[model samples]
Target: MFGGSRRVRQAALFDGASLPRKHISLGGWCGPALMLGKLGLRTEAYPFDFSRVTLDGLMHFIQNGFAEGFYPPGPPPYRPECVGPWVLFRGQHTAFAHFDLNDPRVQAHFQVKMHRFDAVLDAPERPVTFFRTVTARHPQEELALALDLEEAVARRNRSLDFRIVFMVHDQGLRASAVQLAPLSPRVSLWALRYRGLPSDTLFDRTHTAYHAVMLHSVAEENWSAVKVGVVPPPPATMASAEGWDFERNVLVCDGAARTEDVPFADLTITRFPWRSHDNLALIDGVASVGGTCTGIGSTKMLANASAALHVQRLARLKCRYCGDATYHAAGRPFRTDRPFTDEEDQLVLIHLYKILTGGDKVAAVEKLAHEMRRGTYEVICRIQYLTNSSTKLMDSFDPNSLSDP
Candidate 1:
């Protein structure tokens, strides 16, 4: 989904839908605004940390402008642009004020506000409200926020249907904790996990890709097609020399001879240790068709075999590397919270190696826990500390440091 033609296709699909005119980002991080800007939509930011504002404070802001003493009437924290109701219109990058749920003043103004702003405008424009938080003060903070949001929406008029997206970044919370969090009919939680190569660029790309696919599905009203198109079944494994074929060829660069198939016997395929999956797939394919560089049978058979084998290989590779792919099975019921033994640390590294070598991390961790007869949380914590390259403990320590005492 990265090529020029693929981008063009996504753009064309997006062009068909009537997107929101503006986005209202309720504090937290800049991710929502950044994503909205990429979609060519106007965004009104409330800034990060200020996203922790109480529901009452938010409702108050929508009803009235910034209340008296909401921010200091000085030049430091409160700026001219971030004052009054106009602040919402123009948008503010600074946290003018933050009201926690525990604040006595917040409890005083515990009234929900739902206005009909669209009614006043000639062209009714739908504005989406997006909020994302990486902060987790308490274990149930996300669930509480979700519940508070639901309450805010529930008390309001049903006709004023504006989309409110509350995103909570996973902070190593248990599956049970997440399951306990209730969801409204309109509210949906999307758990996007990291595949590999944890970087900002990868995150942006992954989020954008998902955004495109989601838009396409929403536009087409074919939601089920998304999973089908994205996650195809892995092809049968290539084992013996039956339907596999390997060819060594060099590209013909000349303009006239470019169309011709030029075969070069001396082409060397360098096998790298890093590309274990690719090398393994190729070896299996070669062994299946015929353990030789030369053609085994008819051109059609060879071509079909090559295409099918590659397709399967790619499918399996994608599943292994896909962040959204579910790898952990749920059969174990017991949980343990104990210190990791030296032997357990070694097993954790073994699982970590699988993840580094393009294996599904969830599956690896689950397997590690099962094999070691330990809890998944314990295994995860062990891996986290060991892989923390910033610490001297990780740098100085060796995987094979355990001696035969």
Candidate 2:
């Protein structure tokens, strides 16, 4: 006896923060989070590598130690809102890379030995929640995992209390129609795809009109809808718009053009100063507790934290470059290529002296550019003017100021 109507309502909440979905190869949690956000589901993503750890190893952790807050050290699993009857696991995108799941032996292994859903099926209350999706970036891979898992479940236990969902990407729905049409009644299917692609000029950009259509399809549960070609390009007026307004954190599009507003937080996380999005979310086996180095797990979380600090430093450098804080404090507009004051030159010398004395002349000029909010070319010219034996600016200033803190 399933819990009936109450279970339907609870399951629809769609809060799967605990399981933390990611494409891994794609932009990780940021893209998935954005897509889910379009559907009005707020997820605090904590991504982990689904490919590295063995399936049995993951199951063991959940079965033996999930209770008493013994969940993985990454992503602060103790958050109250993160809990739900449904648990989503990000399937390995490359599950079928080398081996075929269709092979009877492999199917048997998953059904008899692996027993992946034993914990969910054997729970105390008969759960009415649909088996939350097993997500993957590749539509073919996700569809395969869904179909095979559903088949294994049917062979052994046909009277499942909850629906098993097979999710296909919108781009993959047309090609997958024949196989999907014949799915068992207990097994449902949904079309969920990420549409946003990385933009060179901005953190991310998407076809605003196409995105609305995609959102509508998902919201209505239209699993048969297929997305074709790439997302349609934005309006022509957007191309003529002014540059990025760093102060407003938005592109200065024409008034007639629709502005695609990506939140600043999303921008930073997506454009993480780090090399890639791999380590943004806390991993189950990889991220240490509190993202520190002393924990019993991998130190990738500590490295992520360090990378976040580095991003903050970069932001500060940009602020100085744009004269944001300094000009704003003085109640003046930031002007570019203004003549440097004598005090400013002195400040530049104080910072550049350390780098120059270290025998890295090129680095000294670069460092001066960052410190003085000037271009590298200008910094180089200024350095030459200051250092020349016959220069007038070098004659008046005391060399002792270069050594001053």
Model 2 TM = 0.26
Estimate every model's Cα lDDT from 0 to 1.
Answer: 0.31, 0.29
Query: Candidate 2 residues 96-160, lDDT tens each?
Result: 11112233443355444223335444441343323222223223333344445455444444564
Model 1 agreement with the true structure over 221-265: per-residue lDDT tens digits: 322223311222111342213211233222222222122322222
Over 4 Å off, model 1: 1-17, 20-24, 41-60, 63-65, 68-124, 127-134, 153-158, 171-182, 195-405
- In model 1, what is the error at residue 219, expressed in angstroms? 4.6
Clashes per candidate (backbone, < 3 Å): 4, 0
lDDT of 1 at 12: 35
